[model samples]
Target: MIDPAILEPLADDAWPARERKRLGGWRLNASSGYSMRINACWPLAAPDRDVEAAIDAVEAWYAARGLPPRFKLTDGVLAPADLAGQLAARGYREGKDTLVMVGATDGEGDPLVRLSFSADETFETVFTASAGDPEDGRERIEALGRMPPPACFARLDVDGAPAAIGVAALGGGFAGVFGMRTVPAHRRKGLARRVLLTLLSEARRQGVERAWLQVEADNAPAIALYAAEGFQPAYCYRYWSR
Candidate 1:
């Protein structure tokens, strides 16, 4: 289990967009009118002590900014047994439950996966084809406007066509894999797997010892695929929104 203290530092390093503030011994993070990824909110006092004041302050902070207060408690947190119910009473509900899967580079098998990465027309085609909504996709790309080059874009083309696309960032000795998508026409043809494997291979090549990614809890097929590739769930988290 990872220590809760690790969260404050990690959150600052990995998720810099959110503002970090320590109130009444609990750390509450918010991004103006945007979003907040609660890093840690453990009671500085005893478990039996009242945390109402702290909770109220956090709510007020969000209310003042007209931003929704959100929290994500991973399975590794020690205070969930004590804090979850209290949070629920305050109107915080579990949102998307996600699996935090990790893969180690040292473990076995063919390090070379038959996948090609190229920057061409196929790249843009894959990105456009896999997007369920053009506006949303464009918005996401814009949100990542600060990400550095090289790690920002990559696409896997299969048989002269765009099959899958992936975006990643390197942080804390881990590659934060995000925006992995496969075109609808390429689904179930092992395209997604091949692309992901290629991504992992690239991460290893970049000296990343571990790779971490999140998948919605209900995404069974994706979970199965990761599990088969030796990725294990290190923890789980659910987003909470009003």
Candidate 2:
């Protein structure tokens, strides 16, 4: 069983923020508010100061940067135990709930899937077209560009057009899948499954032992797809924001 404690940091490194700071064990990440994970503070453990003071400092930090303060709290792993209560008392509302799923890396890769060290034009096209918010797509594309070496950007083309895209961020013997998208016209064709298999196959080749991906809790179709591929839920996290 992969520990959520260990996987959380790997996830952070996989999807890095533009600017990062530390309030003791808490991680303060800011990235233009495109994604909650990149814009929120992750309290993996207790802070150096009291919880209330630490919350004040976090708000101040984000305020200095002209962004709202947010927190990513994982169930069963909340540091200081009462952190959630404190956030609620402070008027922080619970936001998007996400599930972290884990699976083995061993798999047969698809030769038709195009792999690149960076997000190519096709990948960006598919991602941006599929995203509900253009700004979110742009920010994610930028994040993809920031992925360190040994990362893989997987794309599958159908009828000479980009249909599906996914990303694998490799580090610390783990591979994290992000930016999984299928063009609306291409949905239900199992393109996502093929993309996932390709990613896991490459991860295995690169010596990654485990694979992880995050999906919104309300996305039943995606959850079913991942579950069919042997991915099991390891933990759930939600953002706390005003």
Model 1 Cα lDDT, one tens digit per residue, 1-32: 33434433443344344455665345565543
TM-score against native, each model: 0.71, 0.96
Q: In candidate 1, where is summed lDDT lowest over 10 consecutive residues?
A: 38-47
Runs in model 2 lying further than 4 Å from the true structure: none
lDDT of each model, Cα atoms only? 0.58, 0.89
Q: Every model's Cα RMSD, please?
A: 5.2, 1.1
What is the Cα-based lDDT of residue 33 in candidate 2?
86
The candidate scoring highest on lDDT is 2
The sequence of per-residue lDDT tens digits that candidate 2 reaches over residues 132-195 is 7999888777777777778999999999988899999999788999999888898999999999
